[model samples]
Target chain A: MLQTPPARPGMREDEVDTPALLIDLDAFEANLDTMTAHLAGTGAKLRAHAKTHKSAVVAHQQIARGAVGQCVQKVAEAEALAWGGVADILVSNQVVGADKLARLAALARITNIAVCADDAGQVAAIEAAARDAGIRLSVLVEIDVGMGRCGVAPGADAVALAHVIAASPHLRFGGLQAYHGRAQHLRRLEERHFAIGAAADSARRTVEMLRQQGLDCPIVGGAGTGTFELEAGSGVYTEIQAGSYCFMDADYARNLGASGKPVAMFRHALFVLSTVISAVRPGIAVLDAGHKAVAIDSGMPLVWQRPDIRYVGASDEHGKLEVPSEAEAPKVGEKLRLVPGHCDPTVDRFDWYVGVRNGRVECLWPIAARGGFY
Target chain B: MLQTPPARPGMREDEVDTPALLIDLDAFEANLDTMTAHLAGTGAKLRAHAKTHKSAVVAHQQIARGAVGQCVQKVAEAEALAWGGVADILVSNQVVGADKLARLAALARITNIAVCADDAGQVAAIEAAARDAGIRLSVLVEIDVGMGRCGVAPGADAVALAHVIAASPHLRFGGLQAYHGRAQHLRRLEERHFAIGAAADSARRTVEMLRQQGLDCPIVGGAGTGTFELEAGSGVYTEIQAGSYCFMDADYARNLGASGKPVAMFRHALFVLSTVISAVRPGIAVLDAGHKAVAIDSGMPLVWQRPDIRYVGASDEHGKLEVPSEAEAPKVGEKLRLVPGHCDPTVDRFDWYVGVRNGRVECLWPIAARGGFY
Candidate 1:
């Protein structure tokens, strides 16, 4: 059902198979510690988004490093994490269908499970599933802070949905899910600041409305790798759902920090290790990793440590790198590390992550929740 | 390790879980029959690309309906197809690493297996693996033929690689793999014809060169859904590797035929069925299907049977649909069918394909090689 691990323990980096997802364990551990230390006593707990890494092994590491719990987008992901022993899980996105809600409720027996709803009908569906399963499921009323994707309106409409969940015997009102997803990639610091500022304002109003209805908003969750600091400092968001901080991608590295440098809080830990399968041409080389291996939704992957070579184009299974004439062409079978443009979907492409340290394979972790999209 | 199937047999279409991949059985059957009838006596055999639909069940169906065999891009895919009882498999792309080549060579014991190579180093690596595995492996010299991805130069370079394969004791020179990948998506009929025309000329010369070297070219494989007819018509190509015809995507649907209409050869047989999880805002709706559910490399998905709605944007787990003011907004919990922009990566996202016919799920097929990216 899954491909074999690209590298085994004790193997050198060059010996690992091409198109394998490689994690720099040193940088990965540094990111975990850095993020944990940065978030300590910040008033906002880190409910690290499992949707990025999609690995229960990584989730356990994050949990050990002071991450309060894990946040996922699908019930199947929750099931995977729970089965992998992740006790506190939240389906941060909306869980719609009865089949999925039932699955979510079923996990509540062994783990503390929570899901989001943006409408009365979704609340009804979750309620029915929880009631049928004889479980009390935590429900988060997701308010559209600014993303314009999911969630209900912020003020009265969100309060109304919260009341519906409060009225359901099988459901508990968790709080507001005010995620500004688009702001996470806004490149400019000012753009992100403005976006999260508006998002925080909307979430604050929604919380007030809910409090006016005699409901206590225990959790106001929203944040990603790029904007977690803004939300953490906003005093409104209690839970920061920053996932990519543990595995920084090329897109996140492009974001300008307050100090005018690429966000340096986390180091780039994730890489798609590929081999130059074809370099017969003069100034062009092809890699085994392409769209199928590393996602290009953000843009083409950056050739790590090779400034002269640029990933120009990609087909399904091949990525074309434009090599400068002055730079030596990578010979056939030569391996290179590629920083994926996006981490989540790139991580979704593989079953195993070969964790490397000092150019040697140190660990092979199964992406337990990989492709858990139901 | 895979997620549970979204739907079981005998379930209605609406009852199926959201973000599930659906196969319209009727259209799928039509595509198979139409492709078979079109390729009958064309002198080129249909070697359906398994990379498009990584299901051994689908591979068997294609083989049963006159396909010569299946073509894959990865060794794991070949292994999966062979283990699923596919007797013949060609890795249309290069198998780079020694580990991958060893796995491919191991498969030669049970199934007729072949792989592509461009460089002398790759040939040497494959020869080493085949020799170590004690198997005579078939090797194809992939010529650029204008794809500019993999493959050697057309005439002399291809002949030189073919000779290298012929000289190897464990390797046999199969033929030329000259796939014009970019030409497959040419919007105009003239553009595709021109591209494939040049590709055929190059392939024809390469074959002549191989023959001049006293090597018999057993196969000259190329062609995809968009240009299969041209390659089948060309006297030089012995095999048509058209895979997307089995499940036409939105990108392929946008290609114009000779008659100035959408290429009507293949019907849209695959769709991502998603539930409208959020519709609280006016003129906006959100679906459970997004980048994780459907690939957006080609473009955003098309709303099947809903002309008034447009899939405008997508995040990781949510798709935003822009609805016309006059059109009825899709209510929460309403299911909609989405024709994926690119079918290959979209299919790779799911573990199961729910086969539907006449508004009911008739079969559940496991995508046996869903994540076969080695």
Candidate 2:
């Protein structure tokens, strides 16, 4: 169910309910403009990943600022974007079951929809669903590029899968999906450069192999917030699908730059706005937000702008904060912004993004694809 | 938004969509019956935590089998239950803000509603909301037994908060809320025995203090799936708040029995039914379910009934499995059941529960409070 919106348009940030997803509009728009400036002449277009924001509002904002389209991971996300009038979307991950493919195919009529395939059986399944929907769906061959979770092997294996996609009755060969997800969080600049370099080598080899078969690759999509600049400079990747760049998190903020310092490419725009609901002792305080309201898979959330305070632990609905002293303890009903360790899954936990600018709620955008994980 | 139901009643279990929440109805019902039998002659009533299942259907089942009421961690959960005909409900955690307190007070008009307080300021806020709503709200003093997340100290502090609740015109002192959350996962039976022993001693001392202050605890609530037997056997707790007993997860399954084996008190009735989306080579495969679909806070989910395959890593939309060899590889489009690491947050990620019995889907229960983390 869609949750009640946590804030009204003109309410102060503190008046907004606890455990709300907050976006600092100043930092958020700066991040988007920063990305636009960075990609101004890179010869690579931005296809912002919707799996991070999950909102068609955010997708449209990116598109208005020069993003080519949006990329999603689930068919349900594709549906939400299509329903919200996103002109083009790519399911950057595989759509496995017939039920999911049918849902994907139905959206092809409303928007330019594409999906990835790593197996011939899946290509056939996509074809069948497209045929059932009486629509020709664009299918991309995902090649393994260090991120071993999904995708076929890069050179010959990828070309063979592309052939299967081209031979399908109701499918169009959309190109290659080579995303090195592990390379995104590599702490060292040299380490990230090396990983993306190898990923680009694999993609370049596969493109050459596809050309040998008289096939022209229309799109070669990959890159993330941490390594978009590297992929853009590689002169190979056509689309930079960087999602977290627009909402920098603590995990992404940890990525180092060429100077061996934490990268400041993007500002931390996302926060879990939580209230100090309990303060039993001097140095200990508890926030209303927990792992249920914020993501903890990367690490525990950090107390925003308060180096003296640390989020020590999380239960279902409580975030324990360790303060410096009793004299400076957070009072009950005090609101604090928490920098979530991960931005993607934290956004998944919320239904509304309380867009705040200058300490006031400016808008409430529905997290349209919040629970559409299927 | 509520998601489309993954399966219809009468459909085969395998025919359901990938990454769907499945409940083995036979196992689920047996779990309910087992809990009923455990507390049958113990004089302790079950008030199963709705934070685990988040379904009114499941709560109704528990109540029909002699559960006194249901407990939730948030006002949104209490609202979901009250609207769904749960006559008696308790907000087992502290509700901090005025907005949340107003929502909770509004629900009191429909059902028997109560909330918890650990701070004097919070008690005053609840009294104001109750006064505004023209209702006498029941407020429980949450005492810290062992869990350091929330609640005041056990004896004097708890009695003082209860006094504040009793002094308020629009609020009534409900009882004592002393839940030991961490003790629920103590692996060894003896460790669990020791932890709950301390917890029960504290609760007993507090109850005595309240009685000496001319107060009575109508509900001395504490205990979970791991230590409910100890709390019930303590002869002091009137309510057992065991939520995961009806839908056991992998973490709870790790609790040891008296003979040093995994306890077999409750069956594993919950599963994240996921499809193998990609299986490129031997020893590695990927599923459609990840931490976003099924939680990984406690640990990575275990492959149900598949001792050979292990879930190793999870990205946003993919769960990577480490299998043995190509001879027994998980094929693309093959369905697999995964035992989630935690049940509460896993249940929070979905909007519907596909209940299956005898290999067919028997019902579809709406996870009505799915995104109601407020």
Candidate 3:
């Protein structure tokens, strides 16, 4: 069940409930425009990932700009987007099991849907599900471009999987899903450049091998907010799947640009707006938000614009802030903004996003896919 | 919005969707019975914390086994439990903000509810909200019993806040909330004994101080699954708020007993049922469940009953498992059970709990407070 919306439009930002997910509308729109600007000269198009925002509203905004479609990590997310009137959807990750594959195939009748595959057995399962649903399904062969989490090895193994997918009666070989997840967070510009360069080389070689086998690759998708520019400029990548650029998190902001500084391309539009509930001890205060409200897997969240106060620890429902002194500690009932260490899971914690502009609540968007992990 | 339940009754556990929250009914009921048997000689009653299970179904089961009430951390969780026919509820954490306080006060019309407070301003806010709602609300003084997250100092500070609650026209001094959360997970028996011994001393002194001031300390609530035995026998804490005892996690299983081994008082009844989506690498496989499915905040989830496989890394939607070798690797589409590092937040990730008995789903219970973080 969905929790009640924390705030109504036209309310002051402080009037929103504590631990509510808040988005600065100006910064959000600017980040969207910034991603559009960065992808202009490059031939690669944007397929903004819905996993980070997890809302049809945000996905529609991205598609209204230049994003060709949306990339989701789960079949349930694809369902949310399709029901929300989005025309194109792609499951950028492999889906196993008959129940999930059937759900993925069912979506093909409503919208253009595709899923990635790494194993021949999984391709066969997808083919059976497509045939059962009486719909042709697109299957992309995901290749390991240095992440080493999912996907097959680059050239030969990838071609083998592609051939199996293409050979299926109800399945079509869409292209390659060459995502380098580990390279996205490399701090230095050269580190990211080197990692994406190697990833790009693997993708290029695999594409050439498939071409030599008389197979045409339709879409070559990879990259995230951290390394999107690198892949976009690589010329081999046709679609860039950068999700966090629309609402940057503290972790991705640590990535360095050419000048050895944090890349200022995307503004921090997302925040976990929390209130100081307890400040009984000197130099210490507790907020209503914790890891349950804002994720700490990436790291403890940074207190927005308050370098003097540090969120030192997080329990399930309490965030402890280590302050300078009693005089400097945030008072009880004071609202503060926190930049989450990770954006995707943090967004998954809330039911609504309170869009704020000029210190007032502008809109409330339902996070329709908050628990769509099925 | 709530997502559909992953399975129907009478279906095999293996037939349920991947990334489903599974409750082993046999183990879960045995855990409840074990807790009840242990608390038979102790005077302290069970006010099972709903923050872990977050379901009225589980709460009713515990209440049927003689639990005094249910404990929740947020007002929204209390709303969920109260609406689900729970009569007595307590918000075991500080709640700030007028919006949340008003909602908490409104619940008194339907259920007997109380909330914890540590600050004078928060107490005043609650008094105002109760007055507006035309209901006399019970307010508890929370003491800092060494968790150092919420709560004020134990003796005079706690008594002073109790006096404020008693003095309010629309509030009553309910009790003392002295929960030493950090003591719950101490590895060694002596370490837990030492920590909880001091915490009990603090609660005792605070209760005596409140008695001297002519204010009766009604319910002294604290303790979790790890240290409930210590608090139950402490002769100070009248109510034990142990939630995870009915559904133990791996972290609680690590607590040491006097025998110098794991306490082993409870069984791991909860699991995140996941499927291996990719196994292309030599000795590595990826599961569809990641941190988004199973929480990794306490630590990475343990591969249930499979010591040969280690869940080494987690992304947004992919869990990377390090297998021993290719021959021993878990094959693609293999459904594996994972014991989450933490149970509460992991339960927050799912909408339904697939209750399995004899390896078949017996019931589907809605996680009524799945996103009740408001």
Candidate 4:
């Protein structure tokens, strides 16, 4: 029942399957090269965040473009990337539970693995797991850099956690995990700049305090697609960990560039290929991509090539499109490309990305990290 | 690195693993029986929605309980259910492209299958695929029953489409699909009653016209967890498609019952098992389940069993729980259950379901339909 590739391989846009997750190889490579060229000759290293792509194929590409390593939030993501031959990985968050810790420790045997901690209990858990696995684990003291999320307070408290990490024979002090997560999506460029500035100061202070304690800080990681340039330019952040730059989402599109135009780091590559299923009314149509196909946590999906048609609402399987009276309404069998508001969670909704080039599905890539939340 | 089962099968709640999808077997079974028993002699059939469970295992269980078959929104989902041995499936949504339509028609070779449509072009495409495959595909003319998303207009427009479905050599007019989708979550009991009332009116009108056109509608499907009782009691809706009842979510819990209490057809058995990774300050703890683990489109995740702690905000990997001064603050590495606001998409985020009885993983079920979005 499965149809052949939509268009012949290497053909242009008309042959890709509907409801496929697409990544424009041309735009994706440019985004990577742009990030690479932006930080060219700079001391800051790019540890491309795999949480965004969740594909080892993409991860290998990022590595090939001179990314230091990859940063992931879960053990499963690290495992998938590692199995794909990614040698260096940072869990970048606390690893709790005996089961998850054991998985994290096991990854170290295969790759250059590091994890972050904000508590002595978590550090002890990592130490116990590393000891049991007969491996040394790298630990970073996560400093609260104005995100008000996960991380201990900067300065003395951060240094104290670093001491706990350094005290363990099974663990080494990798550095301060200073990430201003909230700064990435501040909307206003100035707001993001100030937020990162404050975060850099906290990280700088934490590094000085760790130095005073005779500890060497190696990896100070943080930054996302929205504000990696600011963090990279700050000269304080050692590793710029931007994940979504390769497949920029609608939310990221809201960020103002230096010229105040939309910063075109990446083209709109990732899209929910939806089909117009119902043209029951005069100036209205409903698409097949709804809450199940696309995540709307940020906002509704943008209808590609049809600015006149606005995606007004969604049910689990149907998205209502508000069509313009003057324009021709979409036909029932017509296809539409949807740019998701938030790409990370939206990508989690699909199993395979129908990799299309020109118009045909050249390949089908399983999102190896699609449901690797555990 | 994958750990052994947290607790043996049939263990009690206390022995269950932290952060697991727990289904109260007793309550779950009761829900299934209750639906079937309620519609026992009413001539209506239960085609349990598989998008809720996304498990072939659950689909088989439903089939065992006299369910006419299963309904899915995606072609991949239908394929999974069919492969899992589900004999009858109604895609319940339109399939647009040749690739998807071919997959849909292919299902008919394996099982009794049908799909809904509201447009001529889509019907043409379906007919084309079915003709090419040498298969007769059942087609349901979806009428707009107050849900303005996907459906043809109620009266003549619906009858016309049904006629088209009946006339096509490769397509048979299955029935009228008058699903009042939005009425499922009207919040107020009276509001839902009135909403369903309007929908029933539209459906009744559509049925009357179909009778005039000599088309006896067979499957009048639609109805969800929030308003299934109304549809079942109406004698008009022949199929009650309630998926979330098997895994009741927080949004359904907010529904007001006839007696003014929360609708209690099903219990809140599903939860995101998260651990407190950072206990910064006395009353604030950070959890591992954030936007990635639990969706927040409906609302932020509610703290399960801990009324004093509020899940304030979420980043990609971390959830912030605001502990009230009166609450007992949890320690770092402590596990807590979070009740997600919405169930359908939230369930889509995880790959494995850590089934807990007491405090142990009694069973581990892969979400077979986890990424079956296409």
Candidate 2, A1-374: lDDT as tens digits: 77889889999998998789999999999999999999989999999999999999999999999999999999889999999999989999988887788889999999999999988888989999999999999899999889877889999999999999999889899999999999999999999999999999999999999999988899999999999998898888999999999999999999999999999989999999999988987789999898999989999999888888999998888899998863478899999999999999999999999999988999999999987867
Which candidate has the highest DockQ of all? 3
- lDDT per residue as tens, model 4, B1-374: 12233445666554454445556565567778877777788767888898888888888878899888998887888988888888989988878778788888888899889998888878888899999989999999888788777788888988898898899999999988877878888889999999988887788888888898799988789888888878777778899788988778888889998898887777777888777778877778888788877878778888888877899887767788999888889887677888888888777766666666545556767667665655
Local error of candidate 4 at A4, Å?
12
TM-score of 2: 0.98
DockQ of 1: 0.74
Query: What are the per-model numbers of colliding residue pairs?
Result: 0, 0, 0, 21
RMSD of candidate 1 to the true fold?
1.5
Model 3 achieves a DockQ score of 0.81
DockQ of 4: 0.49
TM-score of chain B of each: 0.99, 0.98, 0.98, 0.94
For model 4, residues A323-346, the per-residue Cα lDDT tens digits are 889987888767788989888888
All DockQ scores? 0.74, 0.79, 0.81, 0.49
> What does candidate 3's lDDT look like per residue over B56-168, in tens digits?
99999999999999999999899999999999999999888888888999999999999999989889999999999999999999998899788889998888889999999
The lDDT, on a scale of 0 to 1, for candidate 1 is: 0.90
Pairs clashing within candidate 2 = none
Per-residue lDDT tens digits for candidate 3, residues A26-107, read: 9999999999999998999999999999899999999999999999999889999999988888899989888888899999
> In terms of TM-score, which candidate is stronger, 1 or 2?
2
Candidate 2 reaches a DockQ of 0.79
Worst 10 residues of 1 chain B by lDDT: B94-103
